[model samples]
Target chain A: MKDRISALVFIALGIFFLIGALRMPRTTEYGKYGAPGIVPAFFSIMVVLLCFIMLVRKQRSNSESSSTPAEVKRAENRRLLLASAMFLAYVFLLGKINFIVLTSVFLSVTSMVFLRKRFILTVTISVAVTVGIYYLFSRVFLLPLP
Target chain B: MYTVKVFFESIASTLSNPVLLFHLSWSTLLGILVGILPGLTATLGVAILTTLTFGFPPEIAIPMLLCVYIGAIYGGSRTAIVLNIPGTPANAATTVDGFPLARSGMAGFALNVATIMSGIGSIVGAIFIVSLAPALGALALKFGSWEFAILAIFGTIIAGSLTAPKDPLKGWIAGFLGLMIAMIGLDEIVSFPRYTFGNIQLYGGISLLPVLVGVYGVPEILTSLKRVTKAEVVLDFSKSERKLSYLETIKKNALNLLRSGIIGVFIGVIPGVGEDVAAWVAYDAAKRMSKEPEKFGKGSIEGLTAAETANNACVGGAIIPVLTLAVPGSAPAAVLLAAMWIHGIKAGPLLPIQHPEMIGYVAGSFVIATILMVVFGLLVTRLFLKILLVPTEILMPIIFVLCVVGTYVLNGRLFDVWVMLLFGLLGYFMRINDFPAAPFVLGFILGPMADTNIRRALMLKNGDISPFFTRPISLVLIIAITLVVLSKYLPKKRGEKR
Candidate 1:
């Protein structure tokens, strides 16, 4: 079932990219051989072909079976969804808020989700790590961290 | 003769430099820490360090990165022995025998054997690099644009095939998807924008560092968080009995060490194949050759040594192609190649002519890093065990923040951060679906080379595609690629028929 879903996703992606490649300029100053889209078009087509083969093979295979209990699967899904949401929030809000404040909150929240028992310890460690990283990057390594 | 002289000179110069020595000590130590941590891989460690070391001079930065690379590969053995969890994928073979040894109260002895064998393996690999890289570089100089294009394609296909042995189709899809991702920026030959979607940032193409950090780093953090498990250390190293017979064991296994080291170097030289494969292959060969085959996985010292030795030796093997062909021998070597480009050191056939000292310098750095790894491995076995006690929940969040910061600092653009996130999510999705990310990365690195050279070859030949087949090196590579695909495909067909 997972293979089937992934195959469908890849097939969709390949088709999308193939259209994008087809729409790219056909000729460049170097001539038809040096067109901007040729390589991408070739690879996009290859992707589509391979994914189709995968979809066919997966349809025939009946070996995939899930052994995990439903409750465990649900718990794992919840963790994945929560972690992903946190990651998305962190990346999108990185520049809108102060680097240190935003990063500390992100880290603290993630630690809390995973640790589940130590709120104060998680917050303290998160803040300390954020500040230390900020200093290390901006002051020591001389990289400007936004 | 000149290569030998240059190798000695490079080693002597590195030994004399106080700054290099200082960097080497800390970096190798940090690498061990990274390796011992379950979710942090050698590739991630090297990728993140590449970003952090962007400000340093090439001399300092390159050696520091090499130390991390070598140290991380060796460090994974600790967790494999004590916790029954391989710290990095390269140490997966180590756990087969290492944990049983720990279970038998010989954890200290197993670790000592691993350290000694790893150092010896690295020395053997470094010797090969010093001796063979120049010849390979000279050979690469004969390659034309067609050969390069075909070589890039061959690399992506073989990487995909080997990395995803069960289903070569998925591997090919992942590799080609990476090639598609590499097409997002302006065309190299004509400067015509390909897939910018009206975004100005896409004009520069997707930055390799952000993509690297995202693909390797993000999936690790997310997966570790999703399935948080506490790993128990099986034995206290200080409490374990130290058998003085370990030295005798090492002496007896001299031939095993040499054979595994050679096997590792050969595997590493193969494009896209990494240390994990080397370890497994070497371990298998040792088991087959051993007089006591039944004792193999049940606390066999020979098995542990072969695994550890080959994986470390593979580090040296991986660097050879990177220096000679601008093609990485493994995933981490791919990042190292990118880092070298960022340092204004173009690595390829022209590298030897342009920068004669670099190959020797890299070989010297490997030797130094290997020595440091053994010294530290012997001294701080207990400290590493304590690190295993750190909860994954806390450690992962910190690593996540570093990934974000590492991506952002590259160009200080939030755009690159977004790119990293995008690839991270994709990488995680692909991981859950059993698609190998290594082939994707290899394809991405080689994408531009494939695009530019194939086009240039076509233009040079007046749009006649026959040269891709007619050219000697191109013809050989084409045949090799076909054989590799058939080797995977035909076996599956035969299995299905049964």
Candidate 2:
């Protein structure tokens, strides 16, 4: 189901590019450069044609690549979801927390989760490392950070 | 009369800028340090330095940043040769033979040879940046919208498909996805916004920093999320780790150095492509020509030397397009563009007439930086090798944090924060599905250039697409793109009964 949805998303995107080309204004200059729509029109065609090719290829491929053990597939999906959520959460919090705070927190928390390490060691090391590095960027470089 | 005096003055200006010299040397050493360290890379080194250089004088900033670029590319080979791991993606090819040589007990020799060859390659590349850039810059004055549009399309398609040889179609798909994402922001040239959806922040278009971090860095962390069961630095339990003598290795592979250097320079001169491609291509070429192809994988010094030298040479090659046409030669070169913008020295069509000898200054700086890389590389050899011992669990998070902070700092806006998170999560998901990020970056970098130029070209052509075929450059590129696509699908001749 997910694979089908991904394909549909690509096809829809191709349609979007094609429509954009249609709405674009006609070219005004014509001496040496040629038409304005020349590039976009071609690329839009590329998008749609490539998507269709992908769909055909996907269907023709051996089914075994996708038909892995059910248990392994489920675990894989879960891991992907978890990773995505962590990233999403990190991005959302950056503005609210400010740059230094957010970076330091993200570093510590992520270290713990990814390494499967003990929370105490991860947090302590992450905080020290993050703070030190942030100092180097901010103090040494004098480039402003949020 | 005026031209001669101005030329002499530009030379005089470069010599007079002693403060710039100090900054170049110090920053180059910093860049070498950053590149030699495993967790840090040439791109990150530039990104970190870009912000710092923001406040420096233009003369100081440009030279310093270029120095960092040269130094980092040279330094990257250190980790690649000593450890099995690459310090940067461009250095990845180096490990195919570098670590093997290290395992054979030739780490010191490999490192020294790579540094010397890299310096030589960089010098060759810088010559073009100085001389060829002016020639190209002058020619760029004749370029119009049509040329730009075709160039952008060719850039995305060629780079995307080439990177993903396993499935070139997937590469094009990724490029399209990037173009769509780029489209999400308000249109820059026409001012008729397509995907802004009335959000004020979206009106300006997607910022480069977040996309760069999310696509390149976040996915890296996600892919490496699994904990290694063994301790850090996978122990090489080999019996014969012979350290080769530095001078002996140099005498043995002098031709290899010159060969790799020339290849590296040529690759760097092309707009858009950069060091990663150069290193891989040079290594392949070196091995194909070597007497013993089998030695390439088993710690062959020639392989290690070729990869490092080619990538380092790319620094000079990258500068050619950048100084001449304002088109960056590589991914990090895009970031360098922003730095140039901040300096208020326009690098496009008018660059030659406006600041003619600036190219020479760049050439001189690269030479200095390459020297610094060797000096610093050797000095920090022990420290660089030790970095691989650091835990990934501890390292990946720090990189992620830098990415987040980098996005937030772009404007101190909460909106950018959200953008980074959105892309980061999206990027992480893509990694699991085996999607390559390089195409997306290609699209993001070249999309606007493609859009603006294509439109401008069409505007010139009065909506007629035929002119695209008529132009000389466009014709060649179009044929090249078509051939690249067609060749990917061609099946080997069916069981030729030889």
Per-residue C-alpha lDDT of model 1 across residues B1-498, encoded as one tens digit per residue? 666777788788888888889988989998998888888888888887888899899989998999999888888998899989988889999999999999888888888899899999999889989988999999999999999999989989988888888777778888899888898888889988878888899998998888888888899888888873456688565564855686698898988999999999988998878999899999999999999889998999999989999999999999999999999999889889999999999999999999998888889888888888989999985576687876888898888888888888878899988999999999999998889998899889899999999899989988888988888989999999999898987877799899
Report the C-alpha lDDT of model 2 over B157-276, residue by residue, as the tens digit.
776665666667767877777766666554555455555557888888888766766666666666555423323242343445455576777778788878887788777766556788
lDDT of 2 by residue, A14-123 (tens): 67766775665554334323333334455667777777767665443446646777776666566556666776776666546765677667777766766676778877
Q: Rate the local accuracy (lDDT) of all candidates.
A: 0.88, 0.69
Q: What's the C-alpha lDDT at position B65 in model 2?
A: 85
Off by over 4 Å in 1: A58-65, B238-244
Task: Report the number of the highest-lDDT candidate.
Answer: 1
Model 2: DockQ vs. true structure: 0.37
**Clashes within 3 Å, all models in order:** 0, 15
RMSD of 2: 4.3
RMSD of each: 1.6, 4.3
- What are the candidates' interface root-mean-square deviations? 1.1, 4.3
